[model samples]
Target: MKKLLILGLLFSTGLFQACTVNENPQPITNELLAEVFEVKADFTPGNSFRNYYNLSPVIFDSDVLLVYEFVGLDKTGADIWKPLPQIYTSDNGIHQYNFDFTKLDFSIFLDANFDRMRLNNSWRLGKTFRVVIVPGKFAKMVDKNNLQNVMNTLKLTESSVVDLTI
Candidate 1:
């Protein structure tokens, strides 16, 4: 009985010692930076000229892609140009890429009017920009504010806005 009790206690202690959590989550030490790029002209509608922008997280395995589009319009609600599709890449914890709009080609440009203009500039549009973090590696969507806080704390820039004019 005494031996069994001692063995049980020793096993319990060993199990507890082995079950440890990471007290300090690893910090993103590498300097991560994103640059604004133009999308290829081929992807633009009607081969219309437009401007594009993107923000990529610096950390590898970030899996996040933040994309933005800017279209040039004429006075008559006609699109003179539109942004092209952008691409992003994630390695380990860092993300990086540029949207090359100047190289893409496309068909007709989408019409942009008063109300539509406002809708195009909303957060919903911003949400289209996303990082592809691993399934369990990223914070929950509800914790987006916290994630922003984390970025701020790490001194990481969120993203830059691009301007398009006709």
Candidate 2:
């Protein structure tokens, strides 16, 4: 019993020593983090914007990849919001995408891929989105291959709105 207790104590001590938290974890640097891409979508007639959102492409310099998603229609209660999908700004230089409002015909598109939903130009006057821009390498770092992490990262953006004049 004495020998067993000593061995158990030694083993537990070694185990506790092995479990150490990184006191000085790596800091998020300018390289790891980039300027958040800002997009401002507005309401346009379904007939008018039948093809695509006619807004200027929100471009970034030296920004390798961009990530974003549709936040919601309004900022209040009962707000139609969900983290169903994420929008990759580009694997190419296409940080800008042609927002297709006409896709609202199929609600599943919005449910499955929330970022692709086009603003209901007929029913809703306008819609909003929150975009996060990160270099390709850091994209995975931010999300950690988890939707909840991506969702948490999005909360960093206080609010989302579309500025048509953008």
Model-by-model lDDT, in order? 0.34, 0.39
RMSD of each: 14.3, 14.6
State how far residue 64 of model 1 sits from its true place (Å): 5.7
Which residue runs of candidate 2 sit more than 4 Å off their true CA positions? 1-28, 43-124, 144-148, 151-165
lDDT of 1 by residue, 1-166 (tens): 9999999999999999999899999765424332222232222233232324322323344333333333344699643322224322223222212232221211212232222233323311222222222222433432332333334433444353233222
Tens-place lDDT per residue, model 2, 26-121, is 887552344333344443344332223321233244333332334444555433433323333322221122232221110111221232234333
* Candidate 1 runs further than 4 Å off: 29-37, 43-66, 72-166
Worst 10 residues of 2 by lDDT: 103-112
TM per candidate? 0.31, 0.33
TM-score of model 2 vs. true structure: 0.33
Q: Please estimate how well model 2 matches the true structure, expressed as its whole-model Cα lDDT.
A: 0.39
